[model samples]
Target chain A: MNKTINPLSRQIFIMAFSLLMVYPVLWWLGASLKSNAEMSSPNIFSKNPVWSNYIDGWFAVPNYSFTHFYLNTFTLIGGVLFTTIISCSLAAFAFARLDFPLRKFWFAILLVTLMLPGQVLTVPQYVLYNWFGWINTYLPFYVPHALGSGAGGSFFIFMLVQFMRGIPKELDDSARMDGCSWFRIYWYIMMPLTKPALVTVGIFCFLWNWDDFFGQLLYINSVDKYTINLALKLFIDTQSAMPWGQMLAMSLLSVVPAVIIFFFAQKHFVEGISAGALKG
Target chain B: MNSDITSSSTTIALSRKPKRWESPLAGYLFLMPWIVGILVLVAYPMVMSFYYSLTNYTILDTPEWVGFQNYSEILFEDDTFRQSLKVTLLFVLFAVPFKLLFALVVAMLLNKEIRGLSFYRTMIYFPSLIGGSIAISILWKNIFGKEGFINQLIGIFGFEGKSWINSPDTALATLILLVVWQFGSSMVIFLAGLKQIPLDLYEAASVDGADWFVKFRKITLPMLSPIILFNLVMQTITAFQMFTQAFIITKGGPINSTYVYVMYLYELGFARFQMGYASALAWILLLIIAIATALVFLSSRQWVFYENEGGK
Candidate 1:
């Protein structure tokens, strides 16, 4: 008798596992449209789905709604994405293309910084931000990236450096011979060449900042300035009447943008992620 | 003839011209932002954390010097610290292997020449990309709660189940389960590694009448050991610093059963305003992670394979 697990069984096992794995998200989708009492019924699907969960959850609180939080989140992610891409691209260019003093030293430090846990610096960073009167504002979030520090800029810088290095040095030499300024070469030549990498960095930055509960939770205090993650937490914290349905609805909504981004940008996202692993 | 060539080459190397200085100023100009960032953000904060670790500083007041007090207390007297350390270690122990196992299995399955592989890959990977989010944590809470889906599904088999996340006994396990579910990133890396393995080796093994298990043990394991080591270190480091999911899902809950080290640090720093003690804890955590990483590196020489190291 053949003891081997047939390919059909293997495929079936995988397909079943896939369903089991995705069950939570699918259940979340179902539960979002559920009412409070109905949530405990053990069925995620409601015979009569409460579409009002979306509407009510949109304006869950009196003073603040999910809209304000979504706007705040987008603004924060946008600033971080913009700042990280520019700063990292510039830095990667310098590291990969330019010959300089202490280049190896600085590069080594950057790599070391990559492994250093950001949580270790949180307390001091908070103190510094508080000193600057930057707390309760988005400045605490994006200012680090503006100065080439935040959103895992070190990793992004390293990735872009690897990419920029792969673009033949002759391109830089030719651009220079064409009277292209170093900045122009970086801007016109390397920047265009590094689009795939930049997109990868952007996707990572977006996902991280979007999912960031700790960083944003620590800094932004004002409800009006609350990001989506912060706002979702507030649903449990400040709400005396715990409307599980509306809260789950809002939480599900918060995930949609991220999932959509991942769905569309899957290729670049995988490329960026796998490139780091494979190449490193 | 070889000795004459070597002598000529050494002379040529000795006679090589001195290195000319490149445009250091230009490089500095480009790197100015990162330099300033390091000085102010990374360097300055690190110095201050060390200082704070030595002092009795809360956020509201100046750090009064109480040198070594916090460290001594943490090492000797802190029950919560001890508990959190045990929990974090146990978490790393439980979660990393299971996660890697799941990732390798799925990656291997995905690596097969199957149709809709990308679709399967996407489904498996989708959770990982956003797994760390508060939204997913909330979803996890609902799914594992008393009336959650797991219990509901189990109930269909005529077995009543208790709340996984709510019980102190099962809370840590629930979080570990959550970690295991987010194995997509590692799975992707393993998939890439699987792709890198030459088919000829497997082909040769099969031609020799070797069974699948024999082929896997002899051909695949050695080839994949380096990737396994990579995933191990990365996952271990991540597991050590895990906060958001623990904080959100269980709040280190029922009896502080799931209270990870970082969660403890967060509570100390933010909730209690014990910034000094928190800084000390952070530093200690850093030391722990560094030591753990070093241990992994030390052991890697025995198990981790490199293609060029054949018979050497």
Candidate 2:
């Protein structure tokens, strides 16, 4: 069937299908600048673009704005990224290189957790965090990740371990011959050598945590501490006569960070997905 | 003095003590955080969740031992639990296979020698990266609304457009479409898997005068079976846990048409404060997922082709 179509037609078909696939997003971009009056028209672009929608939407929420939400999200993501990289890398290194009792057992547990669903743990974790007085704070997000127990943390460790294992053990031996401590070798040799994997891990961590609306909604109850996700939901609930343009504007902005990161690290991000899936 | 130093060095050599770097303590130190994490976050919570499933505790009070009452109620008595399960299973049934099929088709299209292949892949895969956000969910909800984008677009063609999301018949379907729309990650995975199939196999098949379908069945299907299994298991597991879209889109509404299992669990635990009952619901979900995953793996024996097995 494809041969009958010929390569030129195939190219055109693929191109057309690709455009159709992203048509919604293109429409979204065009609609963000559309006023509410033009919203029901079905036209993607309007004669007069409403650029003020973004400005108005930024400060639309009273007392706190998208600025606060953005900061909260960043602060939370920053801590999570730091913790996940450090803790998962360490754990991966241990699994990749070190010999210890129950090493297989621990590694097996890590693999199991990789498939374990978050819903199974959410309630008990909520109760646990409540006991520690970490409710309504970013600690729940940070602390679990700091220990490689956050969402997809085991997967990160697994990816890193796979990458680290590819590195020759001879490097560690040479570093040891130079009287470098295990920590020193891990920091100086293993970490730098596993840069590609770490970059992959970091991108995934940022994207997943950034898109973790459910976890954030569960823990963050206060508007002041709301991430961009929570605030968006709040925007919906608070607005009686929903300003389509403003909502679209803010919604567009909400995805901008992810889109920007994705565009810049497009290669690593794609490689990371394929690597994790194929390796597993 | 030289004799004394030589004697001391010999004594030190005779001891043969292990170096600090060689000690197992370093390994333990490196894994300490993860160990603590497993114990505190995963292991403990899992055990507690199981225990809570057996008890009746609403976070405001002490958990009282009820000995399987919650499970019995959910399994035997609760209509909503059954409804939620049915809805969720339906959602999974429709979403996972459709999503995988779509991904595979697109992957095959992109696997060919085409111009701007990377551009196409990037454009197609970008949505999956941020697909889970509340913003996208909101976008979906509105796009399918009565007066929203979809209706307006269809109106241009002179077709009657209803509130697709608010209607019971199409609500779940709309959500499935949303899930399928973000088929980028799976497509990329499939594309990668496709690239791994040796070109010689196809060349040999072509020499045999095998048509496209035969070639796909004999070469592509068998080779890609392992990846299909991977994508299948992963997508099924995720589909079973579908929440944000359902929650925001229909709110499990149009008279509970889209009320998924997690939405029911969320309502029970967070809204009604029936933490114990919700814990029971959660355990059942885990069981369902585990069984579903295991069944897929078990079924793979007949279908999934491992290259190293050499057709034996």
Candidate 3:
């Protein structure tokens, strides 16, 4: 009975601590559904929840609903994922499966780049993009992916390389024996087998791109061109009235897509993170 | 350490010495995108930015090289430069330690074999997923505003709570709290590290009737030191580069208390059109980060445990 007391209290502590950790998120949701008058009440639930806040906040800004922003965000994310997965897999195939010139040298460069912080690249990348007239457009984000430098896409490539190396070479050997070209093997055999790693990379790319506030804020300027993250900021920075309820409502809703994705892909997301940050 | 990353990741089979007909063309095609991206996006800017850092070019005109003038000015003349550095350093000092401490603690808690583990882990990690979004910053503003939930809660006890994110005294602390709240990534890593610690060590400790604290001190911590160092270096670098929350929440004011280094760089590069000056600032930041990283690496040799070296 005395021994049970220790484990019992420990379990209780974990439970209570878990609630404390999650209360802010729940409160965020509840606040989104609360009236302005009821905001200062401090209780998470309102006497009468306002479902209208979502509607009101969705269309808070003029001439454009949050629908446009959500679409824009998805377009950016979809493009990034498509390019990142395709290009990273391509590069990973080269490093992992194929023998090439300067393979070790280039691989070394990628490894060295792992330590170079993104902030160092910001100023010059901005200047170069500006020279190419890419600012205030999605091209700044898109072109990088096509070139295979889409934010941390190189890290994605490195991770995919690691994942690919783990796959049995016998599969590649047999596939080659069956007269499969390198590209075909990479596409059919290697890619299919790397689904878990690809999922990890894809989820992280989505989550990171979704919440990439600074990068988005730097390039995107026109209101019509704004993503959900930029739009939420627009609601506040441009407002004199400062619609706290509407802003909070929109803010809460803005996080849903990312939060939902994360909740679903938590395992892959965590795995991807470790593969990139730790194993490297 | 330089050898650490490449040694593990780059060890691929080189046994297939292909025929001359099996040309390197296809592999180059596979790698072309990254090569092009690196040359165009990464390498070009890195080199040009170094030149830009030496010049006095506003975006309006061609840059004129001024031979280390901008660097010297920042080191000697710039007041905001100094202030922002101070703010950013303080941020790194306080936020990184506290955030890592929470991560280690929470990681230790969840390390125990318990039921419903995933549920707790998910809930704790959820904050970090959305924590960097503008939406979360806006939520933080609401919660810390004068008439926000916090003040309202304290109102019942007849205690006045100041606007936390608005007051210079507490604004940085508010940002630190937010960083600490987003300890999910570090927590996840720490959890992984804890799992890697040999179960036999714990079994042996218990067999000897060693208490939890003593065992954790002698066994767990020493084993986890490498991971701890990694987190410390990574978190410190991240804390230095922190911008979004400060940019949105404070916009670097209530008297520039939150005017962090990145904010200053953004202002110099974009708002003031002093791209040349901003480039110099960015380089200095890189130098500082390099020094800090080196210091951490140097210090690591003393305390960081490597099992290959028989740390025990």
Candidate 4:
């Protein structure tokens, strides 16, 4: 029954379908180089490309450039990455290894939070953050992640916990016999061994926090503090007849970091996702 | 001196007393941040959110208590709420199944022992990595705009195309298409699950002269049900909370055809500063998600095959 389509035909079919899947993205690349006049034309790319789109769009936002937004984004991502790695790995280690009171209960809660919609907490969390005077600052972003409750923070911990469980218990016992403390075992032994999972968590933390437009839009209101996402959204709101070519140019730039990371660390991402699904 | 040191170490080992790190307090110590997080960030806010739902708390004034008023008005009187709910439900219903179906089909095709497998996987999965950014949403808007690439392409074929995003009939469809476009991550998960199914099972089926469809039905589907359930729940919850594309691409526009639940909630809470009403909406959203998830789980017992449960 399967021989209806030979292997050679199947390969051709997959190749064609893959091209169709990424067709829009390819168009996006070509369109970003097109002059505004060329936008309506059916040609993917213009002969004389307008390179000014990226340069102009970079400084299009008044008083603040893309540089400022990129800085804000990197700063936010850096802090979130650090905090998520430290906090989530600790929580995962504790859950996976430690025998504490109510461990199962808390672990179950972590699993529940993995599926809970973030919208439920938005209104009151806004109020709470407002009360703390954190509405216009990055503290709201930082504090939750530091405490292992940010977006996908629970899932990160859950993933790490699954990874840590696969590690033999004897390693911990051997370290303990050498007068190593639990913290030491986690820091010295478990962290190094769970490097793959930690890298996965870091990559996810960076990507999710970067793409979190809603949270950034809600919190960082001022121009100077705007992230790349907020800046992009602002670019649209401010421009009545938006420079399509310029807008496309900047949008392409905006996704570059994520694309680069995905390509560079593609293996970890695939493994991380597979592990999270199968093991969890 | 060496013998003296050895004897002391032996004594220490013989005692085998629990180290300070072995104590239960260490566990709490490790969990302290998350504990504080759940209380301050999750638990307290959830309770306060419920309270705010019952009040007339616009952020400007002190929260005036009007118990159940917000809930009553929303449930009984709101048209936009119902519209948003319908749009959201339709979006989820269409998007999740189509995305999963595409993902599974592609996964099956790529599961073969083919050359350039990684290349195909990478190209297909690339979209999902950056799909959620505002940039992609902006790109989507232009792609479906009046003079966008799609319309232009169709025009060349003598098939007239309208501005898809600006039409009420097609606005939500474009959004669903956007969601369906990023089926890469699900495809990856499905691919992994596909690999885990024992080759021997397929080989045995072949020996019995079973066709591809029979092998797939009796072997692949049962083994992969759990992953299917996982993808279903994740994608459903995600589809329900979809805000960025609707907010940016369509702005919930063309007569609110794309106004999702969260967009409505966002308008009420953030734009109009109706924290109380928005909180009510938020609670209902939570309820909807919970029921939906529970329903999926309940339904899964009938379809999802658990190996540990001793194969039905």
The best candidate by lDDT is: 4
Q: Which docking class does model 2 fall in?
A: medium
Candidate 3 accuracy as lDDT:
0.86
Residues B81-144, model 2: lDDT tens digits: 9899999999999899999999999999888888899999988887798899988888887788
lDDT of 1 by residue, A66-150 (tens): 7788888899999889999988888888899888878999999998998888777999999999999999988887789977889
Q: Judged by DockQ cut-offs, is candidate 4 incorrect, acceptable, medium or high?
A: medium
Please provide, for model 3 over B121-204, each residue's C-alpha lDDT reduced to its tens digit, 9 standing for 90 to 100. 997888898888898899888888887777987899999988988899999988988899999899999898888888999889
lDDT of 4 at B237: 91
Q: In terms of docking quality, how is candidate 3 classified?
A: medium
Error of 4 at A51 (Å): 0.8
Model 4 spans with C-alpha error above 4 angstroms: A1-4, B1-22
TM-score of 1: 0.95
Steric collisions counted per model:
0, 0, 0, 0
Candidate 4 lDDT over residue span B93-200, tens digit each:
999999999999999999998899999999999889888999999899999998898999899999989999999999999999999999999999999999999999
| Model 3 segments more than 4 A misplaced | A1-5, B1-23
B170-249, model 1: which lDDT tens digit per residue? 99999999999999999998988999999999889878888888888888888988889889988998899999989989
C-alpha lDDT of residue A219 in model 1: 91
TM-score of chain A of 2: 0.97
Across A23-107, the per-residue lDDT of candidate 4 in tens digits comes to 9999999889988788999988888899999899999999988999999999999998999999999899899899878888999
